[model samples]
Target: MTKQGAGQAGVGQRWTAPQRWTLAAAVLGSGMAFIDGTVVNVALSALQRDFGADVGSAQWVINGYTLMLAALILTGGALGDLYGRRRVFGLGVLIFAAASGLCGLAPTLGTLIAARVLQGIGGALLIPGSLAMIDAVFGDALRGRAVGLWSAATSVVTVLGPVLGGVLIDLGSWRWVFLINLPLALLVLWCLRGVPETRAAGEGARRPDLPGAVLATAGLGALTYGLIQAGERGLGGSSLLIAGLGVAGLAAFVLWEARAPHPMLPLGLFRSAGFAGTNALTFLLYGALGAALFFLPLNLIGVQGYSGTAAGTALLPMSLLLAGLSGVFGSLADRTGPRPLLTVGPILAGVGLAWLGFLGVGRPYLTGVLPGVLVLGLGMAITVAPLTSAVLGSVSADYAGTASGVNNAVSRAAGLLAVALFTLLMLGSFRGSLSAQLAGTSLPLTARAQMLGQSGRLAQVPVPDGLSDAQAAEGRQAVRLAFADGFRQVCLWCGMLAALGGLVGFLSLRGAGRGRQGGGAGENLHEPRGEEIRAGQAAPGRR
Candidate 1:
């Protein structure tokens, strides 16, 4: 090699070493949050069995974490800006790892729920700071590429969460699901040492809105608890009271944020019609996505007789579309605009879900499920990147962080609300259908009681005992049909909501893409950050 060539090679090695560590820390840190989110879902049924928890507790195990996450994430971002980004980020890692250990060791459902809530608090700190750290370290020229690299690596792990969880659950107990985070967390902490601390320079007086965080968390908690209780107890005394408190708490939170000098969620961001509309569309689309995902595994494993691992792997095609095709769609939206892609994507998603609703009691996976899965995957791939572009693009740089924070909150709330509301409807439908079906059919009184007790569980409801082979077969058929009927109803709702989201996007947004129209920015905003923000559009429950 020439002397100049050797010099260039040495220079390349120097630059490559730090960059590799930074990207590694970011990818693993954010991916830890991502993987944990989906892996827990795979363990939900196991949690139910292990803790003797009812379906409502299972919902709480997931929603409790998500609730804390959505409500506190904006505050978390602010905390990082005020405190050192790397310091807060490191603290988040330690907290998350410790919480994971607690979750793994939890002896009861209540204990597990508490641990999950702690995990969410840790996640709120880790998520925003992880990306912000990359922004702080990399110069403007290289920032976009660094963020893109981070998104690509993390997204792969997010998609693999269920598959990994399934393998762990099959090989061992559900405890391993939470335990799996330990090694990953340790890796993140080790890489983070090289990441320099960064913080907002001028805003030393800014204190995080602690009151806003408290109210939002409390309000969402009450709402979720009330909704879950209503499934078992109807609109009774406790449910009504708790739900009322939830409404009041949220109302106060809104009122407080509007008036607070340093607000966690700035109300003024909603002043932009384009931004507001895009988020409205996001809520609807993500809600539908959440419903489909929450129930898909149950349909596969509980009703269709697939194993946990097989059921988990079934979603691979959809995840691949999200992970692989998102970058392609990101490019397409650059030439076009977000509007057309956003409008078309949700419509396709609705049709795919509509196809899913038609899946019979026990149909073949290829014919009955694969086609819809592939279609839904494509639809999601088309929308996510463009939708993210429109969201971040809609706001000015001054308000960009808070704006993205609000949009992120909306997506998480969409999932929590969808699961809570739809599960109620499914239960109501399931009970009525089961009662009517069994009333005329001739089930024994004991069998009737057994089915009624398990009605709220829907597909996960067990096959009852003491029945002969012929009777058990009939019982299983009846139960399957009931579950299918309820699931179909929910799927129909999902399809309709997704279509409505598409319609909203069509009317609210300009026909051209964010790159073309500029999202009120009056300048094009097309770049690699589009890949990162767009890919981040998916929540843990998205696929």
Candidate 2:
């Protein structure tokens, strides 16, 4: 067949049974990567206990994966472009499956963390390749719908991850959580056989920018580690110094990208005003989302005395709401444009977080947590699809995969940074409050020192001998008050971040109805079907 005929045939082939199966396989494979991100949080305590690691140390299992995924995602996109999306994606699946097995078999905390890092690399590769494959196969009109379906599938997995993890942890073992990925990976591999390859426009010209990749990975990893350690050690310590080095490395990367003959990330992409703005909004909004995901379960189980299942189940309503509404917002973006939803979504999220901030100790779940969650979910549903559309539309088609990868990386980084910063702030505030209370009491200096030393676990701390019943009761109340204040403070910060993101969205994002036609040659390449437009097609307002 002639090239023209072949091209037409390929487009038509997308609707066939084989193509549908291929798409389904790709979506499921990619969804598992996203699901694992949220799933492990539910098993955090169990992992820590089993491995006999401190809370801070155990957190690295999650942090390591996310940090690597965020750092390497763009590189993964570049790899797909250089090689073939199908090849890279399949290899990623194999690696992920292997890593999951290793994780399940890990007998030491260090080994587990190492396995998680490997899993992240695989995840990074899988995500961009999967999306790129969709872009390669689907036509413009169907791309959005395909993306919506893919997003919905991943969203469901994300929402269910905690509940699933909770069940496994409570009834089975934490290892089951990691072990579960093995079977899923095998299923994806089997399904992948039906998927065909679609080469990009300039496939041969694409090469991995190794220097840029190295700099970005080192910088991001160092920065994340520093931020995580900042909570335990003061910001001015060695950790901060390392973080500064990481920043320097990232700056160097930016410089290299600017000068490189074939840059991994084209420096010129930021010339698009709408693209830059949308990315900025992504960073902050995702940060807030990450913070909420990280903290909410802890607060529910730790403070509210809810069971693991109850805490996970509590998130179900919010997850369902988000799943139902994201597609609606995607369609609305196709119609009325993304500006209104983008502006309104973040504001609503801010309001919800602010309300949550005011929750006192022992507050009712219905009045405090559930309402906030509901509002947050609605806000997320409204904004996420539009945000994605804006980013993809702003760029040219040739760079769509890279742009998506970058935005995904930024959002993940934001979450990582937010988790680190907020945990520090919350823990610091709680400790300070406890210290102040101890100082105010009639207790002797020795007693005060002892109390302050055990402030970290005040709620569960053993009552000391020779203390009157009144004193014990007073100490308990003070500890409770301190924890309540800390929780409120953290929520307040979340509100501020959400509000700021909303403002950015309002100011920076142009309506899809009012953007430039095409910025560059690379911009208008192959438009993916349904929600999967080329990066250039993601221009602010041009649906």
Q: Pick the candidate with the highest lDDT.
A: 1
Q: For candidate 2, lDDT tens digit of each residue in 243-312?
A: 8988998999999999987777787878877778888887777776676566566566655667777766
TM-score between candidate 1 and the true structure: 0.92
Error in Å for residue 420 of model 1? 0.5
The whole-model lDDT of each prediction reads 0.76, 0.70
- Against the true structure, what is each candidate's TM-score? 0.92, 0.85
Could you list the CA RMSD of all candidates, in the order they appear? 4.2, 5.4
Lowest lDDT sum, 10 consecutive residues, model 2, at 534-543
Model 1, 101-138: lDDT tens digits are 99999988888889988998998898778877787776
Residue 384's lDDT within candidate 1 is: 83
For candidate 2, the TM-score is: 0.85
